[model samples]
Target: MKKIFSFNNIKTLLAVLLLCMGSAACKKLIEIPNPVDRLTPKDVFKDSAGAVLAIEGVYLNFGYYELSQGAIFNGVMTMQTGLLSDELLTSSADNTFVDFANNTLRSDNNAVASVWSSAYTNLYVVNACIEGINNSTGISEKNKQQFIGELKVVRAFYYFNLINVFGPVPLIKGTDFRVNATIPRTPVNEVYQQIVADLTEARQLLQPAYPTTGRERPNLHTATALLAKVYLYQQNWSGAETMAKEVLGAGIYNLETDLNNVFVAGSKEAIWQLSTIKSQLYQTVEANDVIPMFPFMIPKYYLSTHLLDAFESKDQRKTKWTAVSTMDIDGVLTDFYYPFKYKNNTAAATPREDYMVFRLGEQYLILAEALARQGKLGEAQPYLTEVRVRSGLDEITPATQPAFLNAIMKERRTELFCEWSNRWFDLKRNGTVNEVIGAIKPEWQSTDALYPIPLGERRLNTFLEQNPGYTE
Candidate 1:
């Protein structure tokens, strides 16, 4: 088995806080080694062809986004971020699983640090590509501008994931991070502005197309899906619904008849995703702490008691997605049962599956939630039912806005599992984070929502400050 370092230690937190993009990136993001300087932005952008190489590196050096426990690790980009996540603790190798009810800290080892750093590195790379596109005049104007749009959406995705995890962060649009360390944290609102800005520009840049095999690269549909999510996260139901409906109406995507196809690589539903192209997927997944043991690895969370009880007994998802176990009086299995369909012991068993960064199924759900919140539950039913019927569940019939919203959240949690930290963030965004996990985890106070920015960055850049309730 490939061994992943524990993020539980204050030391491993170092990796969790920063990322090593390339030789240049390693120096800017990490401290241990003197990173070898491979290429400079000026040297890279000296020609239009040179700029293409640098842009390719953005995809080439992509890290495994889904850093879950080793098992379901490869593509879980949204695995765990921030302090509210329930991942493995420090000394995780010694302790197999954390006792959620008894643990003192609500967080596992991962934090928003590395995610924030790596995304900026990506932004810098993309922005430099735009710089080259603007400067190197030989390339066709249409091609250069199109490349810029593509690069911006990719950068916007990076920033969106970072802002989601780290709250307000430094927004750099160039390759001067060494000196730019002095730049202070941008307001969270401003960060969102940048994300929205990048994506909006991408919508106009990307061609209206659907790519079946190469979902890693952003397409028009992917941009649309991302805009839908950005609006939903910002609580702009109308904006969210409008973009979501566009994707639904666009003939580019649909829920796969086979639900299992959703998680497998090369599925039709994936919009834009992170692929293990230039990097080894094994390196990223093995380092995960929480992904291997719970849900998929050992199945610790067998549908929260409330969730298992909430579903109607006949609900197809409950039967297909979850399982209940009963032991004989002699402590032997009376009948074996399991609760989920996306089982890939091989995901932990081996690093093969590419994580889905964005997919069409999620877009549908985003549409459902956005529409339902807009007091259009009846209109949202078809999107909700498409996923439900595919999962073998009966069509949903949410009557009121509140009921529809609650069902949408449940649908999100159930449909999107082991992919990202969406489960944790969903509760936070819905204002039910404390209410639901508070009793299950007494350590999860309201202050625990955002992560404590690494103390190192605070010293490196005095302009930086910790998130609320975290000590410097």
Candidate 2:
């Protein structure tokens, strides 16, 4: 396969649209020879129009890479299953890997390997686009700066996903992908710093109003929302609370009239979405769709006995995230579980709606948690209740921070599963991967918190380093 970073040659971009599940068709873009157009940043970003087009490209590009971008989450609920069940975490390791049954992992495992290549490849593409825009002469000056900043912000979102998944990463901030065959890991803190800087700049450059307003494209709101989240990841509660509330007050989004509709698209609740059209959607609903919790892939994700038990009887989430009963062969009724949110697989070509990446309503919950953590319980209650009521659960009156935060976390799980990288991030940011989920999943390792840098990436770029504990 031709690697994406061969900047010296013009190649056709294989645009595989992730519109509907399993029903993708590829289109080739930029099918000409590569040329190094010499132009100052001033020449390109001089008009907002070019910058706008580039931003449009960013949202459009997501369909090409979103699903395969990160696969482990779709495949494994948590690393612990590797120890408890042999069925979980199956893939080509090219190494004698008995660790899953043993519940312990070395740095070189296959599950962690795919992510390093996938995410970095994505970052590199974004970087290439950023560089292309920076040097192009067709855009306006002010828009040029904003476009670069905005792209970095989105890139940071992807990088943060990498950092949380693969621990420390060799941070690549430029378009240059030329380096030796293997690289060493950079520190986690450094990765965090870069994400923060990108988001901060993004927030500054994005207009207060999103051009896709309340849609699933990165806009001023999503950018700020991410900054607050990154701050929370870093334990900057005050900053988290500040940014979270700013988004809340903006009033561009809502909690949705019905909680179920939040995932069903066209709901005013969406902030940003990963989208697909009808013809592009897959005809079959697989066991891996992010909706309704229990995945069809058995060990990859079974509703944790804990997760299954988390909801109260009236909680609307239970019916979708977990499948207590299902139909089997001969049309026999058997009790089992599968992802319910995206369970509808009979679309003609693909799912009609794109996966929502961010929603305005989600920030309300974030604000509730942030404010509650910062000692603003009274202000947090209504926001929390909006989601609770929408989800068919009664609101809680948390008198303490732990209670409030716990509610926020659960709400997020029930509301946002499979669309965003919420589950993984929440596990890391809350330090719950090892705690709330650890005992049942004994195979999880502190090191497994981060994905191992992919072997292919290691073999391709010397400048990029392998994440810790992995070997070439």
lDDT of 2 at 49: 49
User: What is the per-residue lDDT of model 2 for residues 133-211, given as tens digits with 9 covering 90 to 100?
Assistant: 6666766666666677668877887777667666776677664434412335678898888888888888777776555
Q: Which stretches of candidate 1 lie over 4 Å from their true place?
A: 1-43, 46-49, 65-77, 81-112, 210-213, 276-352
Which regions of candidate 2 deviate over 4 angstroms? Answer: 1-5, 8-111, 179-183, 212-214, 283-301, 320-334, 346-351, 459-472
User: For residues 401-458, what per-residue lDDT tens digits would candidate 1 score against the true structure?
Assistant: 8888878877887776435667767877888777876866756667666655656566
Report the Cα lDDT for residue 390, model 2.
75
The models' CA-based lDDT, in order, is 0.58, 0.56
